[model samples]
Target chain A: MKLKTLVLSPQSRLDEVCSEACRARINDYFEPVWNETGRDYTQEELSERMAEAEVIISSWGSPSLTDEMLQKAVKLRAIGHAAGTVKNLVPKQIFAQGVKVYSAAPRIALSVGEYCLAALLTSLRYLPEFDSAMREGKWKIAGLKGRELTGSTVGIISASSTARAFIKLLAPFQVDVLIYDPYLSEEAAARLNAKRATLEEVMSCPIISVHAPKLPATERMLTRELLALIPDGAVFINSSRGPVVDAQAFMEELQSGRFFAALDVFDKEPLAVDHPIRTLPNVLLSPHIAGASVQGHLALMEEVVEDIIRGLREEKTMYEVNEKMWEVMA
Target chain B: MKLKTLVLSPQSRLDEVCSEACRARINDYFEPVWNETGRDYTQEELSERMAEAEVIISSWGSPSLTDEMLQKAVKLRAIGHAAGTVKNLVPKQIFAQGVKVYSAAPRIALSVGEYCLAALLTSLRYLPEFDSAMREGKWKIAGLKGRELTGSTVGIISASSTARAFIKLLAPFQVDVLIYDPYLSEEAAARLNAKRATLEEVMSCPIISVHAPKLPATERMLTRELLALIPDGAVFINSSRGPVVDAQAFMEELQSGRFFAALDVFDKEPLAVDHPIRTLPNVLLSPHIAGASVQGHLALMEEVVEDIIRGLREEKTMYEVNEKMWEVMA
Candidate 1:
């Protein structure tokens, strides 16, 4: 018997998350609702679809499943999200109804990790300076000498999924990794092949990457004092949320030219035209595209589809998230 | 008893290659000539110093040891070169005298390998485009999508020392590597964890890196047809000598917007003032500084010093270069 699954995401994003093969697998396994409709359903429309949907497939931009929605979705058994986090999309009400939830967080974490690794290695080589010099017809410039990642110490903040993935990717390089994660035990750090360090000690490394989740405790963890503690010529990277770092302090640090940074996220999206960091040569900024790789989306979709199949069979779910897990997860 | 050693290199480059500790060790192990002098001796001056010297320490800018110089260097048992290759520095006369020759080629190869890995990862992520766009205050570009190295096929042009070191570094990444070195047998390719591929098949990969030595048979191996066969959106990297690749074909490919390139060496260096490739947004150009990292020079010095100590002790030198090895080595 095939479960009736309703995909709650905007139709335009369906192909972006799920490859054609993945979509075919979902169709083959589940009696999908509205196979070809490109509709982002309104509340009234969702109410009609909820009447028959035993399982829901959600992704980025899907409307939150509230208590009232759950009351209508009496048969709703599970949600498989083809995106990193289910925090914003899956509410406590669904769990109250004894619904199961799974996400593509692990796959998204790997993609972000790959991006961070690339950013760190690129900054270490002083690639931006060389690229600009080449464009301007300058052969070489002062302070543009390349540095090798080997024999250098790398500092990682947080034991978040992305950070763990990044650490795994670094196994081949002969580098010492220092990790600053209050939630992580010393033994846990050793298991990750990283040395446990205080925030100050982590900041002192020549290469520091932040992957802490955005929360009340982690917000502003990298304060003015912490940012200033970083060594000169160190490459500071933040693919995590901006508030997790003291943005003002970071801007000041960049202005002082004491260190370099590669940032994917900022406190504000589309940072103002007059923002000083935008013009700084020591900074490498991207428009929050670290987790937006095409392959990342496809991988997430595959994970979600597999979870859906597993849910139907009542097998163990590797990426499930409950209300308790949500409280601590990024 | 300390062996008598004469330093033949220019004085200015001493600190760049040999660190203070290295110089101290050399002084303790050997009765080094003048302990500290910046003089680059002429052939007559070298011949005068060679009479008592049991070993010679050489580097860049040291004059070649000719037949007449060798006749005067009756006591010379070995020549330690603190640089990449000894071909240009060690003449046939040195070999005829049964003088052992050693070079810092292995250390130099590692540094070049590190640079190439950094270049490959940087290009894979479209980092140059992102850096330039961010500098220009553009938050998002049309085609600045990031690509993960996982599952990507990388094509290597040779089984050179640098290429072998690079293969080791890539062990952690989930990538398939293909090699097109004619000298490499199928078994040898497997040992390097790379599959053997023809030039045409190699060029078809999404990422192509050239590490082939500059030789008569290998020169211009990446021909016009081969360059055109490269898949669209692929990254073409050449940290090796430029003549190994067909320059005109590569330039034409870049102009057509079919692929991107990261080039350290060029066909005509300080590439012409009005070179079209210089200003292309898709091309990344560096002033041939891949193997010029500061640490690279230090490592080379350390290797040469160790080889000198081993040579004096009459032990087998790991870095010793024989006539047979020199012909095939880069």
Candidate 2:
């Protein structure tokens, strides 16, 4: 018999996340019941569906699985989250019930990594500056020469999945990569074709990218002193959580016009209209979109569906998130 | 005895192209005569130096080697050009006189390829749009989702050195690459991990890039109908010569908002102040700098110096341009 699967994401999101092919595969493997509502399921609605679901599929706006809900979900053997983080969707209590969990964080990391690389290349080559000048009827502005990515030193703040993905994309550039992550061993760094360095050393690189997770320990890890270490004419990119950096310090450094930066996240969402950063000439600002893409969304659904199938077949799933991993994952 | 080498480029350019280490290496290998003047040598000045030199170093702004000057250079054995396209610098007669020639076209190609990939990623992800919106204090504009490079198809207009470098940099993206080059064999396309396709078939891809050379046959190669073949929401990039495309047709296509483009070249550069292209919303304009960069300039000097050293040692040079190759080069 096919597993009784429950899809908790709203129909509108499902339209984007799950392609027609993915839905066909889901129908082939499971007796699936999807959320037909145009919005996220209410807690009462989720509680009612939990009792009958042998397998659950969740995404960005899905209601959290509480202990009360877990009590009703006795038939739930697995939960596949078609989104980056399951931290908000799956409570620790669900793990105690012996339910398997899978996440599409790795898939999201690929998009984020690609964004980071694009941001770096764009900033390093002064692409925006050139485009702006050209639009203003200028040509080859004096002293506007750009630098190449080849044979340069790149510093990564953490060896998170997104950081690893970015490093993989950088392999062809012949650049020296320095990674700063307390958890990354020398052997692990070597395997990634990078050198393990202190946070200070990483900050000193001409091109520094941050990919730290949003955790208490990582909050404001980039202090005023560390921000000061970045050299003149350097390009700083931050695609990870905004809280991982000291907002005041970063702004002060950028104000000096000694370096350039591409920032995709902020300490607060929808950066204020009159925010000082908005007027800064040395920075390129974008809404938090490093991990959001149409292709990435579909890939997330495909990954979760495949993992759910592997779970039913008693096979190894690539993205399984056990209790230990969940606690430390971003 | 060291070879007598005459540097024909202006001193200002040498300061930018040749690093201190490169100058020291040149001193060690040859009795070098520096171009002390801050301007390009006149034809008469170049002819006087030609009589005493066994090797000649040329770059942008250097006077051309006319047949009259070639007759005066009795001891000339080699010419090393620290720039792309020696077509403007060397005469065809130089090859007939048995003078070895080396050009840094490959090094410049590396920069152009990197620029193309950067342009593709920037346009695909709608980075410029997002940045603009964010600067205007907007967040998460509706229906602004981007596509990924991971699984898309990329069309290349030619298999020139710049195109090959771009294909190499795309190795990790897992995107299908279609190259439109009549001279490229299926086996050659396979080596690049790309498919050989007709011009029309290549133009139909969602992401189209042009790297065609500026030759009599290639001029206006991308006609109105060919430009119309581009699908909606596609990204078009051109880092090669602008005259290779029909400029009027390209402007009209971009005006329709059916596609986005990042153009670095124009039929006539310093694009007119009131040009309609400057006001277009769906296009990103940049001065012709795809093949120019600080690192690329130094690399050009380094490559030519290395090749010249190899020639003196009776070793095969990597970037030697023979008569047959020069006849077909850009």
lDDT tens per residue, model 2, A164-278: 9899999899999999999999999999999999999999999999999998899999999999999999999999989888899888888899999999999988788778898
Cα RMSD (Å) between model 1 and the true structure? 1.9
Q: Write the per-residue lDDT of candidate 1 for residues B167-243, one digit (tens) a residue.
A: 88788777899998888899999888899998898889999889888878778988999888999988888888989
lDDT of 1 by residue, A1-330 (tens): 888988776568786888888778878988887435476666667776786888888788777776677788878888888888787776677777888889889888888888888888778777777877777777767655777777889999988899998888888777899999887898999999999999999999999999988878988988999988999989999998998888888888899988889899888878765677888878888888888776778777779889867866888878888888887765
- DockQ for each of the predicted structures, in order? 0.67, 0.80
Question: Each candidate's fnat, in order?
Answer: 0.65, 0.70
Itemize residue pairs with steric clashes in candidate 2. Answer: none
The clash count for each model shown is 0, 0
Which residue ranges in model 2 land beyond 4 Å of their true spot? none
* Pairs that clash in candidate 1: none
Candidate 1 local Cα displacement, residue A177, angstroms = 1.0
